[model samples]
Target: MRRMYFIFLMLCSGLALAQPRIQLSPPQAVVDSVFFTETTTVRLELDYPGVALRYTLDGSPVGSNSSVYKGPLALSQSATVSAKAFHPDFEDSPQVSIAVRSLKYNQPLSITNATPKPAPQYTGAGLSALTDRQKGALNFAATPKAWLGWETDTLRMQLNAPEAGKVNMLVFSLLDNAGAWIMPPAVVKVYDAGEQIGQFETARPEPGGPTQYHFLEVPLKPWSSDTLEVLVLARQLPDWHDGAGRPAWIFLDEILLTQKP
Candidate 1:
């Protein structure tokens, strides 16, 4: 009987030794990199072979028959990724953790406080041609209304800059008869005395409203005294020909040129 009891004890010991062992490779959790996208993944390598790997998120079991993670595991947010190994004996591995971060537009500045210096004077010929309706519509009460509405219905303005520096800024206020600011493609030429310095094509115009102000910044070599010649012509509407519809009219209240002080 003693011999039989000893044999039985030995058999139980052997069975316990035969049971599968489950362990994590690193023992402690690890992540490849801290900064990762929502699509980034974490890899949990298993140490024991032939054993099923089970996982949990937070604290919930991932479920039986869950795909064995042979490679990196996918994670969307910053959270703990825990896993365990399952064998017939129900051995389990330790849990793990991984951190993640989110991916953002930067907007530009708005134009305000634009005024013309050394104001312009309106020529009598230009002023006399204005119809009673045009004179009544004049917004700038100040003189040198260098701007004039011609018999051809074209409006012209002559401008000048007194100080030298890069012509880094251009600001203009225009009135649209359509009650909306219309940006017509136009060319702006810069001249120092009689010499041409630079030119830029106006592409983006401010949105039309009761009063539209446009601010354009150009980078050019520094200069002190320059005359700006701006010729603005109305563009035909996509489906309508010129002269068939109301003429495109823009009233200039001010044009400001500025540079870094």
Candidate 2:
């Protein structure tokens, strides 16, 4: 009987050590918008009692020892807010992250004219759409849609800036939806006052990738000009695509001009 009691005690201890730790649910992130002009605030909430929320803004992994959540965070630049819940009774919860973009330095740009106008069905808000701050959703057909789609190989846009300022960067909000045969611009060339100043090209996208929006940032040699011209080139659909041999459609919603301080 003594030997049996010792054996029973050993089995109980083994089972206790083998038990798995429970994980709490991830915290919920509350924010008005993910894209902001100058600043925005993000708040985290978890209803479980005794549970603490921890977060990071620098894309670092959140752990039990991370900074504890005190209140909403005020952010001025682009960042990704990642948060997780922690509790002594349970393992750390899975991390949840939200990305926020800043278009704070968007200078006012006027579209004087455009060659090869967008399709009638997807004109968006017309020429003003290119400079408008509005963004397009994943669904191209969703209303009030903000996507200006072109089925041609190239698009030439005439732009005029009312204010004289030096610009260093241009951000183009483009859509890449393979299912709809819409591809991002393959190349973008910028001309300041009829002189070619900068040009950039993008690699062909992998086939069968999920539909998503992309923000392409092109850095240029800082230059100041009131009148400008932009050329966008479309990619030809690969043989693997359903619309093979044809020029893939290109969709653009907004262009943001950023000037160095």
Candidate 3:
């Protein structure tokens, strides 16, 4: 009887040791703005003591061996900052990330000549809305007026610079919500005086994911022009999607021009 009782006690001890470890809460990142002109500072905060915070700046996953966060990070260029919290007594916290854009925000410009205009219901603030520097929320239903959507295959716009400079990049703020049947553009082409200057082909997303925002960057060959043209081509819903073979919905909130330094 005593031997049986000892075996039972050993099993109980093993069960106790096998209990799942508590998960540590993730660290919170505080920043003044996600968009900056020259430099931006990111501060990470965690209230829990005896926990170490690790971080990465190049969009890589934050591992236990990643750089320990000692202080605020001063970023001079665009990057995705990711972080996590670790404690010896707990499982590592889920990763948290934030994207920062380094660009000359609100560069003086006039937007006009939109062909195959945005759907009337989602016209947003009209042509000027593209350059308003206002990013759209992930929930299109919540901020319907912030986005200009298109059900068609093509969208073209003319951007006129009052005091033009050499532009090296074009950033398009877009939304991707597969459940809602909204997808990002397939191709983005830029032109100057009807001559193609730059082109970008976006990668196709997998079949399922939650709604999210994406910044599509198109790199140009460092050229300047008073008048520039942008063309956006919509992707057709893939066979795996519910609306297969039909034109996918496209949403655009803001367009940013990044100048060459």
Candidate 4:
């Protein structure tokens, strides 16, 4: 009986090693690198006509009971996405794995000095609109939007602290609509108790791969303060880009705060 078991195991290993490997449509997809906002709907595609695709989101191995790839996966939280191709003639394609992180943040209690022209359409109760856990995606603007628009080059806002604590980072989410001429802020400066604490700059458009939505995370040394002020200044569009000379509209949302653990 022992000899038979050993012989069976050796045959199975040999058969597994002979299977053909499967590939994904987008080569950029990899493990632990891709990040998506919670509102993002990611579509996975492969060109293998005869091969069926099976996927799992809870770190489980794909089986006959697993989900079949039919449409885009909506990521509402962090998850490990794994998938593979199957065909009767070919061995199971090597599984592709990736970690998709859902973006969620805790924002400031109140914001002052926004003065966003076309005031935030949905300001609930007070100035806590930006951080109200509401968010907007690429389209379907107006309602259920977490964005505030300031048709200017500069925006200054004061933040009220949740409690006395040490903070080291500030994250701002902005929109870049090339058609609408909405651009990103180039400089971010932080002030604590009326004195400038730190300032950071972001790189402009890359040679390629400029994103429609941009997130700016500025790091600051650990500082204790009850209130912090932020200034966002944007550079005007060059003659080459569209909507030049007019005020560079800046849309902002999610003033996330990060503190050292």
Per-model tally of clashing residue pairs: 9, 0, 0, 0
CA lDDT, every prediction? 0.42, 0.81, 0.82, 0.62
lDDT at 64, model 2: 69
Question: Cα RMSDs of all predictions?
Answer: 25.7, 6.1, 3.7, 13.0
Candidate with more favorable, higher lDDT: 3 or 4: 3
Ranking by TM-score: 3, 2, 4, 1
lDDT of 3 by residue, 33-89 (tens): 667778989999998989999999977999979999999999888778889999999
Task: Give the TM-score (vs. native) of candidate 3.
Answer: 0.75
Query: Runs in model 2 with CA error above 4 Å?
Result: 1-31, 41-74, 79-99
Model 2 clash tally? 0
lDDT: worst 10-residue window of model 2: 161-170
Please write out the lDDT profile of model 4 over residues 1-261, one tens digit for every residue.
999999999999999987755433421223322344445554556676676778888657776568887777776765667777777665666565554444454334556545444345533234465655454454427444556667667777888766545456776766777566667777889888777776878666432232355556677655567777888887576556665556566777566675523
TM-score of each: 0.32, 0.68, 0.75, 0.57
Model 4 pairs in collision: none
Please report the candidate that would top lDDT against the real structure: 3
Candidate 3 residue pairs that clash: none
Q: lDDT tens string, model 1, 103-147?
A: 101011222211221113323223222211112122333323433
lDDT preference between candidates 2 and 4, better one: 2
Model 2, span 1-261: residue lDDT tens: 999999999999999989999989988887656568878899999998999999988769998678899999999887778899988889988788766668776677878888898888888888888777777777878844688889999899887865545567777888888889998888999888767877889888787575767767777665676877889888889888988878889898877777644
> Of the candidates shown, which would achieve the greatest TM-score relative to the real structure?
3
Error of 4 at 200 (Å): 2.5
